[model samples]
Target: MIKHIVFWRLNDTAYGNNKQTNADILKEKILAMQPKIDGLIKIEAGFDFSGEKDSCDVVLYSEFTNKDALHRYQIHPDHLEIKKWLAEVR
Candidate 1:
């Protein structure tokens, strides 16, 4: 299996939404991919509650059956849309 992890430290405000709200939206969009995309073994997203100064606002963990599956997931249209939104939000 292949493990893919991503961390994001969002700006205080972007695209008119606060960091927390944007994180929430991002989490929802990411989680929605599991059912649509094939070969995704597992996926999760969460906010940092560690109380660390350098903590990221959001983290995404994903497991894929293989590198090819991971590559396919990366280019998935839904994911692309989320990526665009995240880029603007951050």
Candidate 2:
């Protein structure tokens, strides 16, 4: 199995949305991709409540059957959409 993890810190204000709000929306969009990608064993994302200065606003944890699955996921259209939106926010 292969695991893919990501951490994101949103801008205080971007695309007219607050950091927390954008985190929530982005979380939902990322979690929604689990069913659409092949070989994606599992995927989840959420906001951080730690409040630590070093803590990021959002986190993504995903598991795939193998390295190839992980590669496929990177270019998957659904994921690309989220990546594009995140670029605007970050």
Candidate 3:
């Protein structure tokens, strides 16, 4: 299995919502991928509860069957769409 993890320190406000709300939105989007993509064995997103100034706002953890699966997920159109929105918010 291959694991991919990502952390994001979102803007204080984006998409007309606060950081925590945006985290919720991101988590929903990321988790929604489980049934939509192939070779994605497992996936989850997390919120930062540390309440520390330096902590990230959200996190994504994913598992793939192998390198090919990971690569496909990286280039998949659905993920690309999310990546675009993510760039703007982050």
How many clashes in candidate 1? 0
Looking at candidate 1, the ten consecutive residues that score lowest on lDDT are: 81-90
Tens digits of lDDT, candidate 1, 1-90? 999999998988998888888888899999999998889999999999886888998999999999999999999999999989888876
Relative to the true structure, how large is the alpha-carbon lDDT of every model? 0.91, 0.91, 0.90
Put the candidates in lDDT order, highest first. Answer: 1, 2, 3
What lDDT score goes with residue 74 in model 1?
A: 95
Better of 1 and 3 by TM-score: 3
TM-score for every candidate vs. truth?
0.94, 0.94, 0.95
Most lDDT-accurate candidate: 1
Model 3, stretches more than 4 Å misplaced? none
lDDT (Cα, tens digit) per residue for candidate 3, span 25-75: 888889888987789999999998989999988889999999989998999
Q: Find the 10 residues in a row with the least total lDDT in model 3.
A: 29-38
For model 3, state the Cα shift of residue 68 in Å. Answer: 0.7
lDDT of 2 at 74: 98
Q: How do all the candidates rank in terms of TM-score, highest first?
A: 3, 2, 1
List pairs with backbone clashes in candidate 3.
Answer: none
Error of model 3, residue 55, in angstroms: 1.0
